[model samples]
Target: MKKLISLALALFMVLSMIPASAEAAYTQAPMLDGMDLPPVAERMPVEPMVEDADYLQIGTYGGELRRAADGGNWYNGKPIEEGLFRFTTEGVAEPNVAKDFDVNEDATVYTIYLREGMKWSDGVPFTAEDCVWFYNAVCLNKIDSKGIRNCHKDANGNPAVVEKVDDYTFTVTFGTPKYDFIEALTVDLKWHFAPKHIFEEMVQCIIDGKNDEALALGKAICGMEFADVGALGKETLYYFWNYPGIPTLNPYVLSTEEGKNNVKGQYYEYVRNPYYWKVDKAGQQLPYIDKIVGVTVSNVDQKLMLLLDGTTDFETVGMESIPTILESQTQINIYEWAGADWGATQIHFNLNVEDEHLKELFNNADFRQAMSICVDREELAGLLTDGWLGGGQAAPAPGQLGYSEAWATKWTEYDVAKAKALFEGCGLVMGADGFYDFADGTDLVLNIVSVADSGAADTYKVLEPYYRAAGIKCTFKDSDRSNIDNDLLANAVQVMLAPVTNIGDISIVLKPNSMVPGYATNVAWYGTMDETTATGDLLKLIELKKQLDVTASTEERTAIALQMLKLHEANQWTLAYVEAAPAYHAVNARIQNFLENGVWSDIYRDMGIAHCQCWFIAE
Candidate 1:
């Protein structure tokens, strides 16, 4: 009865995201740096993803932007791919490779239009045939599927009906109204079309009744050994991004061969695509800059060191990096995007551990809630961010649509008495040494596994004392990133501190990883495709999320989202600390159109909703 009431209220407070209205009509975009195009109006597309208002300058072409990557592959995703749609500063989904789209009244039928003169970076014409090939031949293939995309499927579990209308147009029909499809288009991994020319051999094999050969062709195209093409199919086909022969739609094409690339190499390069479609107001091709240079540093520390030393042009700087960067003598502009990336530092209590006693205690709601209240969030924030952020927020940050104060404030108190009561109920007793002990006369020890990094090591230092004050012995085990990843998926680590991802979006609850057993401990293994692994509350969440995908009512969707948050709050599976904080990044002051207001994201591969095409450096 109590659960029902809270869910009812949460449904009532659902956020109605007001989308930005389109401009009345297309207007000629003005150049930012007051530079003119090279008179190539005849070569430009009929329509381009225009940002006339955002351009701060219209500068000349021919300067190389020097940036640092932690590893070799970072530049491929950052500079090489462009999604069908990109989310603008106003949180609206605007067309990118696609020109425009229309949906039927029932929302089942969507018609998409392509920019007529647009071509792949290799000078091949982009057409409706390419999109249809991507949908039917690539995405819906039998041998190895990319798995069914949740957005493209309907309530009845039917795949979208795709049809090619003409050279520059195509239609996708869902079984039901799919509102989330638009936003899904903005994500990088949601590639709607692949260049059919490069994979023609695989397509031909599929048509000629040679599927094994087709699969082999797919593997070979991705430059992999035949042994690596296990049943997973094309999931490993990331080789297409930098495959020297494959055509791309990005502003710059990778100039280096994939085999020769080295992570520890001093530098790599990307040259401009002559067939790039977007143009400036003055009729010059977009991507005013001619080249993108990625300089590889040995480790994470070197990235910061180079940035501070004024050697690198751009890199993300965290809050902990602020005091140090500010103290540096380099004249840099620090763009402090506050609450741009709103994830919390959280500790997941692994409920699937092999130890029966620990697992049983962790599964108890009271035990979980008590641990939630045991932390001093104010102190954690002070130690981590020097007091810039921390007022007790939970999984969904304040800016997200589903954020609830009730959920955020749940069990967030430095209550010693309450923690003692809750811990006592779980069969833990106060020890002679003023710490908690089990019935077996052993001190209660919490082993927190973390990636061995300077930042993570610093966090454990603060959390250890907080647990100690509550009569529980605290210990931290430093594990490398590869080990932590394996431990989380294999359900090996009993407890670990990880930053909570998928914040600021109510829609994210629909994803299988976050709310399921795969990523975090203490949650039932219910969200995976294998339904037998989960039951009860985990199953309930899965059903609610499916309903969210199909439900038409805004209030109803909000209620469902709120119910999930409430369930997570009641479960208290994670101890979340410090949310809605400022995230900082430093760009070379000479770079233009890098940071904007009201838009920030943490994921680096997509380049933080990157706009490298429009950025230019003055001479």
Candidate 2:
């Protein structure tokens, strides 16, 4: 009888080795016939509303706009200096200093005409010369400015050069024809104009007298490398600005007053740019708010609590806090969480590694596909969050550019059996210890790395069990935010949970070449361009992005978008997930026309706290 029992147990184990049938499989639905979604007129434009006389008029007066944020340097927000030309919201570019702009044939050259009479806050006349000089200081000269670089390289892979046409006008020429040149211009933070007078004067001082004072001034303004300003001609300035350019710009002049708090929060207040050129339809001078005060508070919980208490106007919240925030919704109205469909959250597979066993498991397209099937985003969303922060449609989050509900619904579904079948069918047999192993005797284990922050810590804990049940060994590693740079460069991480900038421009997010040096936001899983055999689909997506600038028809753009989506779905660069916590802005209840999106700082101009025109004190 004992022999019979032992034999029965052995038979059961043998049966388990046979692959189980999948409860679900990839279903190829009929290709969607082009159906007209809502007309472009019905959908929201990047800038949805023009000024209206009946627009809520608030008392335009002096008041400080207080905001709380996680740790960031004054250098970080220095891009705001680019004024009129910078991005206020995702995918939308409005004139900052330029009253308006004009583009030429093929959208390669952009002629930007600055609004005359605009001056630096210091009362110096801001001219076309200033614009040209500023461009040169940051881009052409590559001065160590706190701006972002937007222009493409020449055929030989050098920064594109700019030419000044006149005091009010300058033209930007790209190395390659860029359809989204204007979009790129608007989002490039490095395009911020510096006061040429201030910069040139410093350089002249250094050249006239190469003393310690002059050297100190040069270093203060341009860093230690600028000890000899004589060599810093137009060409030299271009490279200098590329790395650690002076964080100088017009929007918010930097104040030297030091703060007693953390260095991150020390001594920076953004005063209104008196030279700010944009005006309301009624001809009122813009930037209605008196001042913008950014306080550095690194703790996320403290930041959220401050928001609840009305000490801070805005705070970044994620999925873990959604339930808590929703449960306390009576405190305030949570504005739209911006990243609903911006991009996807993906489990990236490292295909370039030389390990035979690791490559065989990870590079197996079927294995990856099987892993994707078992991940029920809906269930994860429920377990991870609550309220509006739950499982959402895949692809671009809903309400974002290039989002398709049909595609989202078709791809995102829960089927555990299918995942199991695919796992077993791949010839991974279970061992006596209950862990699955491949034919060559390799066990499946994964190490996930995330920033050592509260949000990430909570998320990793929640996801631990799901991976364990699938016979996969899961390990979590915590990394400091400061070490993120070195970690990514050294390939010291396997999986990283980080927030990507959501500007709504797909080109910036997907292009392999887009991940330039200093632009560490790009997921490094793909490695640099020299390292990988980027598929034809990726190359085609880059080509389509270049076409976005000139393509006149939405249909053409949509077709390109669909192709990109199909590729993304098949390859899984991003794993689409729901926004866990929408951002919450607590106003004085008198503020009106406050446009809130998922992006931070996008609605500053429209806020009653920033632009006072739309605000009124409660009676």
Candidate 3:
């Protein structure tokens, strides 16, 4: 018994000395103790998938693809002379020719690394020096450059500082700490990098009095005018290099011959770039598809017909096509998804000219509230788009960074009597001409302008009767796309239907500088608010945005966002409308990994078209 007790005590002592025999240690001992172990894989709480994880994996190979767009000049889309970046279907920004990147502590400075061997279609080597030269010549000078315009200026509007560390290393210094610094490196077509060697030689020749030689060189380098060599100093060169002016950077180069003539009802081809940097997961060269064809069609109707017949692989659809697409659902595959296209439609009012008569009629807060109340957004949505789109507020959508839905339910109801009473309380007297009169008995004529293509004309037609019953003479004017600028700039119309793009970033859409006044959108005919006050407020909000990380709590950010929303809403620039018909797309069954964020409207640079290296074919 004594021996057994001793044995048990010895075993207990041995076990205690073995350090508790844990399944695994949560932490390792210090280096001085010479104990280290690999960390166990932590099991994270499973998160619900926002979208389907398993997607169609369309293999990259031979397939003829067709796409459509409204008539516009290639120059209209060109920011630089060459393609530097291109959008992906997934909408995540990826490196084009750039192999990788390194960012500094405050994120103000960035070091970009390029692929070892890259060449332009013209056979010129694309190096980091080209990037540096381009920035120095174009972006800084803002001379028709294609570079984005964030770090180039301080909040006070000073030139952003930049330096080139080495041939392969470039550094950018911002006047302020901008978390979105990496976005600045994106390529714009107008600010596309020209062969520095070629351009410099031309400049040198011109400086040496060889005008004829310089002119020839200019045409050869990138078709630029070199008449004024004296004015083409280093500063001006830099400005032209960094201008944010183009839509995308990708492996495909724009064909100049096809771009010139109004090439309608034809296909524009984009071939794979042999020098493209990205590789597939299987180590195959990117842009697996041999070519991309952009086909020009008369309208969405024709495009939809072609899509259904399998004559075309892809085309952007309008609201009118949604019903047909749905009705013909089984025969045709539809990938109708929500995404950012233009922006939400808005009712814009001119706020600069203070007409007491107009003010007395519209300035009454209740009258504005009543105007908002009478419009049944859901009903209007059904009528305009057949209910494919709905639920966005006059304020931006909720998930947007600076968006506020606080006033979404504030006045979104159909109450015609309440609207009339609100107008009556404001002392707007109904006149014999079926219109309301001010205190001085002046007739209220509100002219509303709308783009010819958008369904605004039809929308105004529906509102005309309702507004007339409320003693308002609302005149509707439809203008072609070309005449829209003249109409808005001249303030030729009082009320206009316009889109407020980037509603998520209200500052871009709502500021006085916004195309529209009183609204965050540019379609507002009124000029932007006092630049000093609005800009100061914007700067504060921007700073607040920077301080808050992506992982910040929604409640904490909501307060600041609400304050910004209130500023824009109080100005009454944009009478926000619920989404009518959000754009939709259809994809083939064989096209795999087709994913989209809520804002994918038109094809943009971030979507993974170039990266996916896949082709869509009829199953």
Number of the top TM-score candidate: 1
Q: TM-scores across all candidates?
A: 0.78, 0.69, 0.67
Prediction 3 global C-alpha lDDT: 0.47
Worst 10 residues of 1 by lDDT: 15-24
Q: What is the lDDT of residue 328 in candidate 2?
A: 59
Tens digits of per-residue lDDT, candidate 1, 452-516, equal 65366777787777778888887877775546645655666777665324323334433434554
| Cα lDDT, model 3, residue 435 | 74
lDDT of 3 by residue, 1-619 (tens): 0111234333422332212233233121122124232221111001100111234352444554455544433311321222333333333333344444566665555566654445543445566777776566545543322233533444444555656676655666665654433333332132335557656566556556776776675555434444454433321243232111111234344444435222232555544444433333333333445555566667547777777776665554665676676777635445544544223556766543345466444435677776676677677666665676663445544554444455555566778788878877887777878677775777778877777767677778765666676777778878875466555545454567653233333222112224222232243534333333233334444444334323134365456555645655554435655652344656545454445443342224223332234443434
| Candidate 2 residue 96 C-alpha distance from true site, Å | 2.0
Candidate 1 off by > 4 Å: 1-44, 72-80, 141-146, 200-227, 230-245, 257-264, 340-343, 349-363, 402-406, 427-458, 461-496, 499-540, 553-560, 602-606
For every candidate, C-alpha RMSD to the true structure in Å = 8.0, 19.0, 14.5
Clashes of 3: 69
> Is 1 or 3 the stronger prediction by TM-score?
1
| TM-score winner, 1 or 2 | 1
TM-score of 3: 0.67
